[model samples]
Target: MREGWEYKKLGEVCCPKNKIQRAARCFDSSDKILYIDISSIDNTMQKVTDITSVTFGDAPSRAQQKIEYGDIVVSTVRPNLKNIAIIDRYEPNIVASSGFCVLRNTECIERNYLFHYVTSDIFTQHLMKITTGANYPAVRDQDVRDSIIPLPPKSTQLAIVSELDNIKE
Candidate 1:
């Protein structure tokens, strides 16, 4: 833990939004939007590197929670499992599984820093505490909204991200 880096809940930095719930439309080969499910992410890295098969008409007509480049996507349903990913590309559309939480740092918070923190042991522990249910665990929208996070200056966040990247390399 570093100075000025406080613990904030996942909700403090992001809002929860799901793709419009409607009947799954018939799949068409020509559909434009790319469908990325939890399976698309690599188990260890939780990052999406390859998308082999694409299905059409599966996307919501009104995609309210589109994922943009640099945004962090977290799986809320099983926070203890620490399933998460950071979007580094500028995609026209990105939707996640119903249990996932999309976090958009409001420029004040560093997306990369938040991305790493969400997968840390400490954060995962916190999520486990907040999550409800035993057999079928679940975290609600309000639960994420009230989550606390450390608010650091941009420079510090950049440094943390750079350091983490180097360590990864």
Candidate 2:
């Protein structure tokens, strides 16, 4: 840990709220909704690339995680594969599969920084160790919330993210 840096539980830095799960019958069949499943994300790109547009009646039972732009959705299953993506853009009626744990940044942490941290090897390795199930290993949402993260000043976080973005380009 560097000076001015502190280790904080992810739940403290990022608040994961809006756990609204509606039954498929709650929505109208004529209404179209943008559905994002764990598989629809291209983790390498760090963005949601593919999504399905379906009527609420056609939505899968797992399509109950509501998402907004800038939210970070990470697949709780198979954390080693690093299925994570930031919700950069979406239609007004966008919902994600329940397999994902959505993270919303707080004032203490930058959104991009939180996204980068969750997708890093450090985080994934930690998850790999605690995740159960040999064939379909997965961690609970509380596991992700309880994990600790190193948080620096917002300015420093932005600088680090900018440099990483440059390297990607």
Candidate 3:
């Protein structure tokens, strides 16, 4: 382990800042929302590119979580496939499927750092090992929260994320 680095459960660094579907339901039924599901994420690109525009009345049952600009959405289903993305685009009413484990970063952690960590091979391997179900092979939010992560100092975390971002670009 590097100096100034510490191991912590992923949950310690982030949380889900979500709004429930029931809140959306209580409002006007004719309003449209951007719904993100496993399919909405392009795993090959590691980006969300397939958001569905659906009216509240017709939204799927799985569209239960409301997400924000920087939240990281990890597909709880089929962990081996590695469906994950950080939300970059913003819309007022963006709801994600229950199949996603949405992680919003806390102040101590950099958003991109957490995003890169969960999408990394280390985290995928962790999820694959803990997932249940035969056909679906899903992981629970608890499993993701309990996964361990190595955190360097805050400055190091930002520097690492910047380099990774540059490589991606």
lDDT of 3 by residue, 44-63 (tens): 88899898998867988887
Residues 1-169 of candidate 1: C-alpha lDDT, one tens digit per residue: 6776666665555543433222133234355555555556665886876543344454544222446676676776777766678877676545455555677776567777888877788777877888898887877756655667776767988998899999989
Clashes of each: 5, 0, 0
lDDT of 1 at 129: 88
Q: Rate the local accuracy (lDDT) of all candidates.
A: 0.64, 0.84, 0.84
Model 1 steric clash total: 5
Instruction: At residue 151, give the lDDT of candidate 1.
Output: 64
lDDT of 2 at 7: 94
Where does candidate 3 stray beyond 4 Å?
A: 16-27
What pairs collide in candidate 2? none
lDDT of 2: 0.84
TM-scores of the candidates are: 0.74, 0.91, 0.91
In model 3, how many backbone clashes occur? 0
Candidate 1 Cα lDDT to native: 0.64
| TM-score of candidate 1 to 2 decimals | 0.74
Highest-scoring model, lDDT: 2
